[model samples]
Target chain A: MNPVARLSSTSTGQAAPSGLTGATVATNAAESFPPLGIRRGVLLGLAVFAVAAFLLSLAVGSVPIPLDEVVRVLLGVQASKDTWQTIVLVFRLPKAITALLAGAALSVAGLQMQTLFRNPLADPFALGISSGASLGVALAVLGGAAASVSVFGRAAYLGDFGLVTAASLGAAAVFALVLAIARRVQSVITLLVLGLMISYLAGAVVSVLIYFSIPEQVSAYLNWTFGSFGGVTWQQMRAFAPTLLLGLAAALFTAKPLNALLLGENYAASMGINVRAARWWVTASASLLAGAVTAFCGPIGFIGIAVPHLCRALFGSSDHRVLLPAALMLGGGLALIFDLISQMPGARAALPLNVVTSAVGAPVVLWIVLRRQSFGRV
Target chain B: MITHRFAFTRPRAIHSAPDAPPPNGDESAIRATDLITGYRNGTSRRVVHRGLNLSLSRGKLTALLGPNGAGKSTLMRTLCGLQPPLGGTVWIDGEPLHALSPERRARKLAVVLTDRVDVGYMTAYALAALGRTPYTRWDGRLTAEDEAIVQEAMRAARCEALAARAVAQLSDGERQRVMIARALAQQTPIILLDEPTAFLDLPRRIEIMHLLRDLAHQTGRALLISTHDLELALRYADALWLMGGDGTFVAGTPEQVHRRGELLRVFADEGTEVRRYLQEIHQRWTTS
Candidate 1:
């Protein structure tokens, strides 16, 4: 007889080998809690931090309005000077709100990209979005009559609208191309590599444009690249806010499929998730969030790459349900804090938003990578 | 006593009528008819097998055995609806496989593959809860009943204690059990697995085979496993599907296939001694 039959015949009543007994099976079923209480605590803390950061950003700008006055004006109590009111309500409030939206939007996009690609290093900007937006602005300022149009009437108004429009369209075009390529590629690493190549291609195009453009236009492009949240007006927010909200909403709906995708495509499909449809939804939502933010905020970096890592580290869970809200709060809070620091409080010259963001964001990403001891997630 | 007499009278009359189809056909959970398995490269098709007919009956454990390059994975993939057949039809529990939506198909058939799941942060319970994906709402929130089902699947797969543990931290055997629990939580009538024992040690391999066999018999669910462990397959599996070197398939009881010498046809090319060894084993089994 065979060894299997010989063993089974020797041990008639027992189901499995002695090594795997009922007692051992019972012992093997050890349970561990997922730190949900801690996650809730982190969420609450982030929410508070985000609110405080927003208030600080509004109160500590060039005029340095008192916190009480900032609150009073915000509550419409009429305690501050009219000039202070104008700075607080007109200039700083919208800018702070823009910072909040851009931070949340980019962070959520980054989370989706990281999860979908199963790569920890993937960011919203990885798909050439920032470069695409830069090329758009470059073409408008250099190739078009944007400079001469600024020389005409209503210069600030027309110029901002034209640049925002150009940036949006340019980001959207590159996003469409990435999605088109993504459909054919099954491997996440391949998709990420394609995104990197596209970024390089867009960067090359932007460099050629920069070389030939006038010095003033070149400066304009360079200044935009440094990034800021100061220029988004109420009119712009109407466009920016809704798109970000819609993208976030779409992302939340994909929370289930995104979790399934963590196991890879074959497993996700077996779980009844239409892999292709989920991929499309993820790509569309990620593109909309990142693309719209770049159009308005000049492609703010770091938060998109860093906030998701921060959320994962805090919550100790990969479930999108928790990570989504956590990222939103943390991203908004971080962006507001950086914006406040960049304003230089008492000084007239403000630091570039990207400089403040990268200084903060790069360290967090580096620390996470080292702590995890891996550069890319499997 | 009158009720007992009545039960016997009516049931006996009904049971006497031969209304049921042949046992195999009546219990078939999945059937493939004249399946042409192959891969498509650009405009050309490389066919693996043609005129293939196979039936996996409910409450049966079938072991799909084949050598390397025998297109076992391709056939398994095609049967699970992961890839479209080159030219054939697959029916699941009386419904056309293609006619069912992915959600509907999931409700009918669950698949367990050898691919490693790299989700580090999810607990085993949450991963198993994903099996309720088809039944859950669009947002994928688990209702109380869904949670109970997930818990029951974990218990059945003997991973209940590991429910709270991170999937990434689990050992290979533990992870495989959790994956099986996830498939069980899917609650489908038919489960297809590709090399479920590929990475396991000898004891774990035997244990997994026993577990799968018990699950199939107890749940009345059909299990079709593709594996390289022919010894365990012959011992535990109720039926065998052997893929030949020339891309043909034969299905029968292990004893029947061995008696018919079809096993030799597939294993002969491995070596003359291997074939002789198999013949010797067959002689001992038959004599015993």
Candidate 2:
């Protein structure tokens, strides 16, 4: 059935109230959604932008490779120089892929958090899951287990596997605590506040661990805190990629429940949704996504909170089915751009990932907030 | 003028059992037997009203009239399964409400709550479309049939013009209509509203009440609205369920309940001023 046509036909001859006649109709007409074609066009544009950004990230680094050569190299044809192949394959490829995965993972996680909590400011880290991961990493690097071996010596021995394991455990601990608290708390705000408190407690423990540790262990932990997309190598991708994909799939599954939740829990319950079950799945999916990214990439900031809002503005719809994909693409695309800027193209020194993220992200978010007069509707 | 535009027409039965007998049949849409409604905190329990029997008949507009804190909301909540009754059984379409699954319960009954809906950036159509949640697939996409129902509901509620507008931008009256449309879209046999007219002005309240009465008469659905608008309830409701704060309960047609002095007894604590006001309105209404 043509709903729009039917709607117009039904409303045309009806004597609508005077107050709703002119200005209301004009304003409502202006606010009417663009057709599905325009939304699809936006999604297509985002996908292209993401692909372009990925190629640009591969092309622009300390040793710049030509775009065609980078494309040829990616396509498995031989490049002009051996070093170019080594540069693209060994260094930039994993890093770009890491940026893509981490960006999409965090952004999707953030979107879930915002919806689940009904808070516009909520992000993947709003629950302090990242703090829990940091605690796990801190314990591994500075606690007695690693104190017995010198920092550099232990790095060679334990590898990234040990750190990833530690981070995952920490995030899991927070996830479990949040879930337990979530079951008992009737209000999402209560859960949000409790998550914040848990985050602070984890951070406090990490600080004390840092204070007691040897200088080398402390320095190692500090470097990890700088956050990087370069840390995940080809070997680690085996675990990182699948875990994030699992989390993303779970997030996509929640699009429907999340949409229902937009009306609040009571209404959702009235509509036959198992509100408790929906909350559990949403919390689990968001925690998994946020936790996995924090495990590999350290606590990358802003992408989770920023990208969802960006997508909402760009697409002009709050529907999760649209926002999730938009967030995934725009998040990856924006992350690559940020990573490229952090690299400074030819500059020898690379800025910390978090620094570049917050610097670029904070202003854009502020602009959106100031212009819209509120964060994108929760 | 707008009232005339809302002239009611009989629509197809959107209920699951379309071929069922007409609503004038004496079957109860919802029945509460020996129901105890109250609040329980841990080991402690506070009973609001106990041993009450109430039933809402199909094709009827039943107004639950009560003064402040007379357990009207508690009773409404219990009937809708938002809260478990402290004792006894509340049945919907002859099935125990508590025993039914959430999906089954939703199919049989829909509720328009007084709780504020703060759905950000959702268009009126999308908000109304959420009524299809119980029926939609995992992804919640609406089928063509579902779309037609939603369109029909919006048309019935007279808010089809507001379909493309964001819910956040709508006035209270407009929002209430959209909410009613959502309940209509649910295609349930029974709809319960908790103070659906609370935030509206007198004209809007009268309009809403008229729309609801017409909906019940035309669609053969049972509607029970808990409201404080006694004058309107007396004028429009098929029956009145009076809940006295002192735990007394009475149910009958407005005139029957008034003749029995249930209205005076329910509002006795409101002092002589309120008693005089009630009697004066009742006298004017009946004499006219």
Candidate 3:
């Protein structure tokens, strides 16, 4: 009986399972980039996305344009094609440019905010810059003041530029208020709460103005809140683009000092930085970029809060030397991607950019809070 | 703490012009003639100290010792330009301190201020490298030489192990070492440390004083440290600046201060138990 059992066991083991033995065999190799090598790969992906985003943006919208025709049109060469010319020149090109600049500006502003406030949660809107600018725009458009200025200034051919200039100044006034508050309030949470409170206060004012105002003006003011790249035409782009670029360039230039700011103001000063002046410039740039985008393209929020986190997670270093460029590329790409998602299902079914951003952004923010709670900020 | 208890002899007024610096640069290293330091509250005011005269120079490790509110820290802050001298000027290289560029002043003098540092996300290397900020361009990139000096500073303060770690995670003593590292990295001719060893354990405290004295001797850099540790101060200092009540003050070589009995005058009170402790320390060290 024992012999028969041994023979039966031997027979059962006759067919041995085979295992793969080559280098191609699945192994527990790291699926994520190593810390140092991450920067190179993320940066590469960012560049690819930035280019792809540009093409996708150019090929999108109600007008049907092929990618090759759009590319030709973009190059300033005559597209032998007709609809391509209209699509590229009229719709996609301006929207694409607006989306790109807006993205870059918001991300850089976010990066500055996080560094200055020393909080990972700080973003362009965290200071209430967008809300403040929105209030300014609402006042201008609804107060019957901007309408009069628009008519008289454009009638004289000088008011066209005047409106945008007024808009920027209006936004700047609120930014200054926030900066002063930020100076006195030392804690980041206090500043953040202050910003949120300011936003609510501004919203209240806007609501009162809208309730007392005519329906048409109310609709226009309401439209600005949904956010749009479509509003910034070539003329608006000309006025808006420089403001965004200058702010971005300044943030990029300030990368090193931002590293110093991690040491706190007194230490930063002892380190030979003009601490007061640096704080001023940081506040000013964050406001200027966020305000301009809000003024021209409406209040775009979630991108400013999300892109830096994404960039930091991808690159694995808070050093601005690598982080700034990565943030810039990733920011521009993310903006275009969000814009693409918003524009899905054609013109009639198009969504707001803020809606798309919030959809992506809220979850990331929740993930951040949960992760931070589960394990500290380490 | 050697109490010589000698007769006081006031210094004769040298008939040099106020504007003309003396040819002897050593005498001109630091001078506070009848300085009055204080604070303002709206229209009201209060004085912290008055009629103070102190001079320091290169090749000296000076210690300022006093009870709390003897205006020691206030005076130190005023002298270092963190607070404006209410009734006098802080002159460096015979010019008003306020007139100098921040960078120029930083190069001439470095300070390790009382710590309330809140620099999160900064590495020890980053913190030490900040000492070279005045010498750096607006972009603030450190040169190879700057990097070397920062590394040397880490070694000098025995913080080489903590170089890559975040400043927040460091212990109090380690933080003190980091701050000293920063000042050392500054490479200035005049360095001031505010209670540099306050957070340190006994051995580390002695190590810091030894490092300061050796650094002063080798580099001929003037070092001024304020502390309440009478024993350590007496043992290591080149001179003692004693701040007495009602703005009474005297600064001299350790021998001179002992002879003048200023330590006994400021400390060793007849009533309080705290004074008894001071008396005991004073007696023990002075006798030794």
Q: Which numbered prediction scores highest in TM-score against the true structure?
A: 2
Query: On residues A1-378, what C-alpha lDDT tens digit does candidate 1 reach at each position?
Result: 222233234334543323112222232224442332235777889999999999998888666788999999889888548888888889989999999988988899999998888888889877777778877777776655434553221332256877788788789888888788777776667777777887888778778777776787778777878888887899989988999999988988988888788888888888889888898788888888889988888978889999999888787788887888888888988888888888786767889999999999999988987776662443
TM-score of structure candidate 2: 0.89
Off by over 4 Å in 3: A1-45, A60-69, A78-80, A125-128, A141-166, A175-204, A210-220, A312-318, A345-348, A363-378, B1-24, B27-30, B41-45, B198-207, B253-261, B267-271
* lDDT value, candidate 1, whole model: 0.79
Error of 1 at B245 (Å): 2.1
Docking class of 3: incorrect
How much is the lDDT of residue B158 in candidate 3? 59
Lowest lDDT 10-mer window, candidate 2 chain A? Answer: A17-26
| DockQ of the candidate models in sequence | 0.28, 0.32, 0.07
Per-candidate iRMS values, in order, are 11.7, 8.9, 24.6
Q: Could you give candidate 1's per-residue lDDT for residues B194-284 as a string of tens digits?
A: 9999988999999889988877765567899999998899899999999987776899999988889888887767787778877887887
For model 1, give the interface RMSD: 11.7
lDDT of 2 by residue, B1-288 (tens): 112211122222334554344233447888888999998889999999999988898878999998889989999999999989999999787778898888978888889999878876678888888888889889877776676566567766778778888788898999999999999888787889999999899999999998888778655678999999998999899999998879989999988987777788888888888999988976785677
Q: Candidates sorted by lDDT, descending order?
A: 2, 1, 3
Instruction: Specify the highest-lDDT model's number.
Output: 2
